[model samples]
Target: MTETETAAQSSIWTDEPFDVHAEDPFDRGSFVATVVRRIQVATADDPSTVFGLVGPWGSGKTSILDRVRSGLGDGWQIADFTPWSSGDAASMSLEFVNTVADLLGEKAAGEHRAKLAGYAGFIAPLLGAIPIVGSGAQGTAEHLLDAIGSRPPWHKQFADLSQAIQTLGKRVLIVVDDVDRLGGSELLTLLRVVRLLGRFRGVHYLIAYDQDTVEDLLRSTGSVGRSAAFMEKIVQYPFETPPLPRAAVIRLLNGVLEELLAKTDSHLDHLGLQRATSLVDALAPQLRTPRALGRFREHLNAFADHVSTARLDLLDYVAITWLRLNAHGVWSQLDSWRHELRSGERATSLTETEKLTADIWEGRIAEAHPQADRTGTLDVLSFLFEGVDVRERRTFIKHPRAMNDPTYFERYLLLAIPEDDVDDELIRIVAAELDPDKFREAATALARVLDGNDDALANLAISRLTVFRENYTTPNLLLLQFLAERMHVRVDEAERVGSPRNGLRPLVAREMALAVLAGETSAPDIIEMFGETEALNAVWMAPRFAEFRDRRSDLAEGFARFWADRLRSEPGAYIKGGRLGGVAELVTFALEPEETNGLLDPAVTDYDSYIDLAEGFVYAAEWVGSSYTYELQFRKDAFRSLISASTLERYRPQVLEHSGKVEYDVEGHPSRDIPPEIVKAFTVDSLSAL
Candidate 1:
């Protein structure tokens, strides 16, 4: 989209005033008309009356002033003097006189324009530096001096200007706006210009200001006594802008919110609307003016750009954005305590120190939002961070996209995925590719991709599949079989030794495959897929499938036949690579004692072959607790069940000679070898009796 289209879709307010009465959403048209009528009457009756339009800052004072100016009928001379634009007393006074003269000269006849310019030349040099207005100002001053025949006294010049002003057929009104924005000297200089220097027979002043801010500026001058009394002497008639109704502000906010939500095509359900309404109502005190609503729109618009708003809990997002903008201290606290605040069911009781810290945090939040209701704020916090201590009337629904989910809390705060974290896109792709006909091609394409750490992206993909397994349909064994084989590709044992992030892909893939099989009821379909898979994959998966075979008689019978055929065809492949360890259960299930001995006796004749066979029974111990706890352990029962007593006797002398005392330290020795326990299990563990 183009920039204009994006801006058109946004609900952010620019905070500009309405240009016409038809644009008044705050019911200020009648107010503007009334103020204009009073100014007209006051200027007509008293030639030099001072009318003051007063209100607090940002209370639509400028809008009302503009509307009144636009509503007035023509034929009156009006000059707008913004004293805040000038930096000092000299510049402010010079700019004010020039503004009035230039505006009046625009419509005056040639003779009357000359008189107005003469009056400006007479008064401006006395207030500030000469030749300051522009290069043409000097020539005009010299011509005015020649016309007067010489430089006159100050009082005499004032009298002459007063007489010349009465000749004009129009009443002159000088509108000085935002006077409260001036500094001490600049403000005093402006008041002097309005009440003393510029006050003529047919000139009137209409000034818009915040009464409180004007008084404060007057007092800051340190020369004025009783600032309010001083202002009364300057402004004869004072009126405050009309009060803005709360309902009107609420209506404006609702309109902006509707526009924003419409762009997203978001509609809140009944409960969602109720919750959002409650949150907005709780913030009513802060949204009492057009400027406040504009600021809120700006903040929310920026927030919506960073998060997944479609899946977001809309009410929760709104409340969070409000807290971030208005209650900054509380937002910082939320960020610091995010882990504890978004945790699931507690596993243990809180310590006394932890409870005290929580109480202190609550007190700090209350102090930050002192004007807000304690119950309302806490309820909002509780809803957004579910672990906070607040009860709900109904069960809380889980939305992973919401800020309350622990997995998503950092994503919301950081506004991007962390480096080690898995992207939701991978999970989405895995879920989409569950079709049996397309699984192999998609899985193969995905497995070749690498992550930032240069590891196979398939590891993270399979891990995500394990986490979201329930979301998938019944078994897609082809995908599972592919993952099983891809995961078993050898990783450097030294690289995986101390780092928990490495070398667990096969385990995750195995668990995911089991989870898929648990949902499958067709035994023959699973057996056929298993038979078609590579020998390494089939053997790697056999133990897990055997776990459920007691309830599946067809699997028990079919797997035995499949295992016997693979062994008869290529038994040496498993023996040479130490993969024979994983298929021990199949060997015992499929072959009789004599058949197993005949197939294995010749395969284990050498020391290297025996070690490889023994390596199958050994597993790297679970890396838990610490590095000292990681070592190789052998399953003696599985080894004894497969290797016959005669074969054990034949391998005993070589095992005793080659396998010395085993060192089980993983940190000191990162490499793995067949441990002495395997040798003992093979030669001296009552296996000969068997």
Candidate 2:
């Protein structure tokens, strides 16, 4: 690509420093002008002066130097030197002297060039020998002073060279940058040259470095408490790079986001645009400097490209990017949590160690980016995961629409997984609409190919079922069965409302039951397609079958006969098979009140069956209260029948002895009221009858 094209494609928050002569995007021109004025005033009285630009790494130190160089007028001559490029301390000093000589030669005419070259030649050998002076070489500095005293009146030659430059009335500015990047010895040597050797008339030095690093380096070299004193002697003026304003940082971030969004063909609606803006505003405080903002934008751009921003939840995307940038430890923790949440596990309180780790990480982030509002970042996390406890601060997302949407968490998982391993076919399938026949074909093919190992595909299938539930005209038995089995594995591991086994299966079964009652399908056909467990599931969830009894009485009658035969063959097997809830649901459609009573009457005659039936009644009572009143009345009648006057006389003392009180108040049976007769059957009055 051409340079223009490349620049067009580049992120607006590029880390490269702005050209000094270019338009200042950060509005740093005024600051640069002020520094230039100070340097000019300071050097007016003193011919030689040094100014230090102090800031932390990636704090725009070099950019400030560029601005200073660009601001100087024609009366000044400037040479820029980076000591880090030179190999050692000796070589750096030699390079500095050579650069000054070359600048002087370029400025001077014929005879003065010869004079400047002689002075440069004389200083070259002495600069090379300065390294030995610290190594205990005998007669190093003393010998150099003596040698200078005897040779060609060297002091007069230097003075004449200085006067020649003074006659031109042009001040030479030597700019040395990134001195803190050098080794301890190299840094000290560069300081010595600027402070002691290069102190010539009509020349000023502007050096830039991180003050703390250079001071620590000096202290490590035996300067200890005197490092600040030494720095004061070398640097006449010092200035710290000012913190970039929060508004400027946000504007730069938004500029990059707009560029990225405009270049891609992604469809961001009003909600997506609002979320993107909120993310930028939320993270604006943490991005204090130009470089930090650049790094954050870099991460965001790469993630957007990797995940493909089309139809994505921009808020979740931003949250994942922030975690990746500032709180990577938390990012890893969240990835693990995603798997756990997908596996149908409940989110419990954090363990002590986990709590400690989270606290330490939050503290680290807060300390590193004090300008950024960490509370906003933590709030993003809480929105993504339902139970993320960021200390005692309870954070909830303000956008309820985004939080309610399933795509938010789905997009988060897409970014959390490795890019290479993402199942693109599954993602496409979940997002697209499939007809009943196509859904059955695709679901069956996927189940056959995957053999149940890929949880990502399973998750996509479950999500697809929700979309299909509202749109598909006809129910697909094969698709529903496949999803049920896949979800059953997760349910067996842990039963949670988020699990497809517990959450989607009932919805799937209800759809099938509706098809059967509407005569769109049959019970035998359903049983043939899915197994008995699913057939039972369909009958269990179709309790409203009575509403369709007038139109489909034949199917209701057939269903009641089928369930009656099953109950007679296995007297208490339905309750033992963990279908107590389904049995209660069947009361409204399949089983009559008399049939239910007959099914449980044998339980009162048999002691072992009575215990199981009693437990089933307790569960059924709880389950039926949430159903239609007819189902509740039928379950209550069955319970009252089991605890008849004679039956209660035999078992009431055993029931009272085995249990303290017969309490029927539980979660599912919110308003379940036990019959006063049944309550009296198990009370102290029943013991007298026994």
Segments of candidate 1 deviating more than 4 angstroms: 1-15, 26-43, 47-59, 73-77, 86-94, 98-173, 198-205, 210-216, 226-229, 232-284, 295-398, 401-423, 433-470, 474-561, 564-678, 682-690
lDDT of each: 0.58, 0.58
TM-score of each model, in listed order: 0.64, 0.62
Q: C-alpha displacement of 197 in model 2, angstroms?
A: 3.1
Give the number of the best model, judged by TM-score.
Answer: 1
lDDT of 2 by residue, 1-690 (tens): 223323533845566776666665566778888889987774422668888888887778777888888788776878887777765444554566566666655656455655544554455456446643353322233333334323355587778767765665678888988888887766776776676456778788899888889988887766335887888888988877787877776777677666566545445677667666666766777776667766776777776764453334455666677766776655555544554322223435574223333354356447655543556656556545544445654333444323234444544645543332333344345324245555555555555433455545455555544554555445555555555555444444554334435545555565666567566777666666555566666555555434433544444555556655665566567767755434444543444555555444554566545555554544323344436231122244445533455565566656666553554322343343546444333433223323
Clashing residue pairs found in predicted model 1: none
- The clash numbers for all candidates, in the given order, read 0, 2
Candidate 2 RMSD to the correct structure: 10.6
Global lDDT of model 2: 0.58
